[model samples]
Target: MIDINFGSLFTVELLHSYYKDQLCPDFNILPSNQTVKTLGGHQIIARQYSNQLITGVNCNGKINPPKPFTAIETGAQFTFFMQLNNPLFFNYTNLSSATPGKIYYFTNRNNNVSNGKTFLSSKIAVYNAANTYAPGDLVSNGTGITYRAIGSSKPGNTFNLTNANHWMVVDKNQYLTEADALKWMPSISAYQFASPQASVNISVLGYDNIATTYTQSVFSKTIAFANPASSFPLDLSFLQSGKYSLTVNGIQQWIYINDELSDSKTFAVIDIFNDASPVSCNLIDGSGALINPAPHYSIYFLNRATIWKYILASKQSGNINDTANLYHFANPASVITSLTPIPLSNKALNLKLTLNNHDYSPIACADPQRLVTITKGTDTYPCSEIFLNF
Candidate 1:
């Protein structure tokens, strides 16, 4: 019997061997970096413009400092879940008790830099301290010392000076200084941090353009896309000229394909396979334009143990006018849910139910106690409401 010791193996492999075939991504050909403003890490990261709590996203833990087995550089361009509970940046921030959309302003006190901060009209969207704001009117808060928005054209955006509850007032200690300010912006804001996952000088892929080969880690899975590519719909034969490659970020069974031709044609997702659960899709076009697919499909299992399926025969194209990040893609594959036909109850009630949007519905049974009224455009129909307990 031969005994093999694993401990001696580490002594065998040299440091250079670990990075032998390792390739530092081509910074040039890759897509644009996802420029963003990083807030706090491993610590409570927040911001204030004219003295209010605009947004204070917390860092993993001891953010400003490094910990054991945790590299400070890991928090460099990205935040780590090990330090912060999220470990992932898919954070959903909404208006809550302590948080609300607040105005963030950046003014050149000295006006030294040629291209000083440019002020963008504030909206309901999130704002970091990196933005430019013109103080509106200086009004007194209930505390008597009031803060104001910079622009006079609009009503003065004021904050409570007494309490730090406002979105623009973080404790002097928690606020980010100018040195670490850019991290609080959006990732796509620059070209450095996000360079690794890009293919060419493009940040987001154009229709039919091949995306840079990259890997993304989400939750507990690492998804790799083959030289990420894009597709646009044309005559079906034209699209067939490209080769199809696939990489999956979900379970190994789930798949997404990258079909790219040598020339710059539009890229289209060939298929999404092995998705047995409820899901949604975003249908958009090149230049991040949202294209409404006339025919759309959906399938989902409600939280109450019921399955549903829908097929949209047509859509109102106007709905796709939102921005790139806000665009939605539609389902290309047939939605397969566990929606079995069940017999409707025979019971009849005074207040009958009326359902609409029958265009996306398939032939299925309905609850006898309720009435169904489906409408696709001007056409309308009332399904036979027969009641039989059996």
Candidate 2:
């Protein structure tokens, strides 16, 4: 056996030649410049603003500097993890300290320039002696005494005081001379540094239009840049066509996915099986507005009893007004105070639930003297009427 080092001078064909005698000879290495962000690699991490006392989050991982990495350039995306001890959460809570399972998402709003600095055009200047500086240098003389040097210059202590053209102050303060007096002094305010936060929070919520309630409650998770990276992808397909809320730490945003056909608003082809008949029909309400099938079906079953009561009152006394106040969407939980079977006669006529703008259910009522009361939670709907035609 012989050892061979490709040493960056490699190709798929070269590797395949050595294994030409094998069954599967196709082999190649992945290129290093792939754009896909992976959990296995290093990523920059930052904090998300919130009202919690998290102190700080520390991840034992490394941050891969932004593409074209330089002292001025920062990465756009952050790759992090969710580990037990690696993230090391420190919440100021009483029970178990921090909320064990929280969710979070990354955002680019906090991607601020270094010290919020702006790179501006520089001017030509000469070297100085009284002051010491470097080329491509930007220095703050004091709180507001800042300068950018087009060329290296040390124009002595009073050069800037005499408005020397060698140095340029970003903003000349009202006390400009006093600030420039201590340009090179070892002042604590001169050194500025900012390290990005270690972790961020994410929240996701889903909703359904027909259900009139959240598809699911808001879920939260926190991510950190820690050792033994514990990263995972999130799925939010359950929201369907309705709007959703996504919060990264404290910043919130609403997202709406347009799944509706642009040409139509009242109809929706919910379950079409390759252009065939007998698929689930378009779900619509009395107003012809499209609605979810599950929620619509639930409303039909819930109001089954109320539909029966209305039919009974109308037929017995030939009084259509007796059932006028009855709503099509009846409450299924409604109680039956009394249900009496009226004798059938030639005057009796069969009425369909669909005629009253209600969905078809298996239940049917032939009697005209049935009294029922539907109790929905704490509310009660009592139907106790003896109809009589005047």
Candidate 3:
């Protein structure tokens, strides 16, 4: 003798009210000759299929010629699912004769077998313990709620299915009736579709060389694909021609525009040579480009040889006597070229340039904005200014 289990799970849920458009559960599904339970004067029924009693009442057991499960009273729409297993027999041909009224039904083929193989179906999506679900596969959460799989995983946690990230809700949004949904259907006598649009992929990068990192500075957008190379119409109108180091996406990279102004190797070299005027020098940018003023220019000169090295901004007129107590070199080494200028101001070989507006430049002028610094053997000089003529 063998023991056979004839029990199967079933779910019944009240979906809509008498208005059909509203989803209030003021209707009840009862057993034969069962009285409606009253609570707070207003009638309340099982709205969700998770309600055990209503679902169990809809299950008619494993009896032959299965009895009509439960009948709904009052004006309301309901949906139910029943699983017939074990020594039960159900014929799809005589389904209408057995159950009266407008009945919507489906067969549960999970336990049913044929030719030693189980039937694979997609039409009626039902989630079970035995079945494995793949991405894009539809599954019922047993509460009449259908969810589409986002990844290949066994549906175990029933609570997480309600979250949109794990599963996409399909059957939950049945708020509109069939007639209301069909209202948007277009009536077309004749029509033709245009050609489909093409799609192109793009990647934008921002980098910082100092930090050695690269990140996306601008968002990449899709465009129409073309045969030849094409560029995005971007406007960097606000930025000036200069070297800039910026962090994008937490990455550091050197950004250069106009010229290599932002290059690590780019620097301004002020070469001070032994000349007739000790202030006569050459000012070049990092790229060896000559730095010249537009029209009106002034400068500051610092005396690094002495303890007083701070420079003040001064202007040049027709004479060099604009300021008193200015340092005057008695032995002005005028044509002392082809010699390296030392950074030490105290040293005899140390040649520090002066900032000036005219040919007879100001002595010991240091421009802080230009970041001009005098370098010598193992020493550096920063200066202050005074007006002078060449």
Candidate 4:
């Protein structure tokens, strides 16, 4: 019989919330070193380098701690609870049908403040003899005209086209009935009519590297408003990694799905000016030609340390009066100084330049190292060997 001893065995207890936006109120207090007994009654010391506590059980009793257990792991082995804070109401003000003078009218008579913009009350109802009307109330006269009430009217007073003191014609388009307007109103707010029954169509199309040729229709979803508002998930897990365009109603935006297989290299020329100069440096490409039109690339300074490749500074192309192909860094040192967790002192760094298309697809350079090593004391450097002074 072979007796293999694996040292002491123990369990670690952790109390934490697995919420996505949960914040740590205070630092956790944990034992830096703990003594435990093995199955054979041999004593062993368990230790933790970090004072912070994480969610995991150290069953192997290894000196190095285990990583934090995730919700996916718990869902597979044990019963897990998930709470979704979904949106239950959609504001009718955001609907394309609610443009000014269309389904509703806005007047400065009763102006209010909302989200730093002038808020005008919407008149979205037809003239009703039984309904009491207030100032700035908009109502349709059942024909092809819309009127705004300048003065309060009692419940029994019917709207008259000749009543200039109480009513003013604002729009002559086809009047929208109260029932039509209620279809787009919010379901939970103070101005809610009934559960909004409006629906919207969303379409997604996949594309190739250039985005000029369409690949295929990726997804099409129709969201029907059953209760003022509802939330639905867009499951694109089945899509192959590539560029895609999403269209909601008529508005479209580009999106990229990265499978971690895309190359991130590009060719760039670096020029470092003298200290205390107005502009610290400029970055261009080979052939001494600027990238042109601006903001098509991003530059980053990364420390060359083995353990931690800390980002010393990062800047995007484009500056006022800088329209050429070259990206000018006005003050490179100020960029490093403004970092949240500043970089370490006296560490040698390298510059990484990445170029992208207008749609943000990586434009890989044919020769990655065409820009050679840039040594110190030289007037200009390539993309390597940079040391910044504090």
Compare candidates 3 and 4 on lDDT and give the better one. Answer: 4
Better of 1 and 2 by lDDT: 2
* Model 1 C-alpha lDDT per residue in residues 62-150, reported as the tens digit of each score: 32221212112311221110011221111111101111211112111111111121111111112323344322112222222223322
Model 2 lDDT per residue over 1-390, tens place: 332211110011111101123111111112112212321232211222221101111222133211111111112122222122312111100011122112121111211112222111111122244666532234555444445442334545334523433344434211111111101111111111133435556686764323423355556778675643333334444434323566654765554322232222211011111111111112122332222221110000000111224433333222122133322333321222222212222122333233234433323332324435444333343232332211
Which structure among the candidates has the greatest lDDT?
Answer: 4
Please give the RMSD to the true structure for each candidate, in Å. 25.7, 35.5, 40.4, 30.2
Q: Using TM-score, rank the candidates from best to worst.
A: 4, 2, 3, 1
Assess the local accuracy of residue 248 in candidate 4 as a C-alpha lDDT between 0 and 100. Answer: 58
Better of 1 and 2 by TM-score: 2
lDDT of 4: 0.29
Runs in model 1 lying further than 4 Å from the true structure:
1-170, 175-390
Stretches of candidate 4 off by over 4 Å are 1-198, 208-211, 214-216, 258-390
Per residue, candidate 4 scores C-alpha lDDT tens digits across 1-390 of 432323222221111111122221212222211111121122223332232112222222222232211111210111011111212101111112222211221112212222222212322456877887654456777663656554557766655546775665654422222222211111112221234336656787863223323456868888776664433444565764334566655556554333221222111111111111111111112222221321111111111111111122334331111123222232223222111111122321232332222222221111211223222231222221222221
- State the displacement of the C-alpha of residue 7, model 3, in Å, after optimal TM-score superposition: 43
CA lDDT of every candidate: 0.20, 0.26, 0.27, 0.29
TM-score of each: 0.14, 0.16, 0.14, 0.19
lDDT of 4 at 142: 64
Pairs with backbone N, CA or C atoms under 3 Å apart (clashes), candidate 4: 290-325, 291-325, 292-325
Angstrom error of the Cα, residue 73, model 4: value is 38
Candidate 4, residue 251: Cα displacement in angstroms equals 3.9
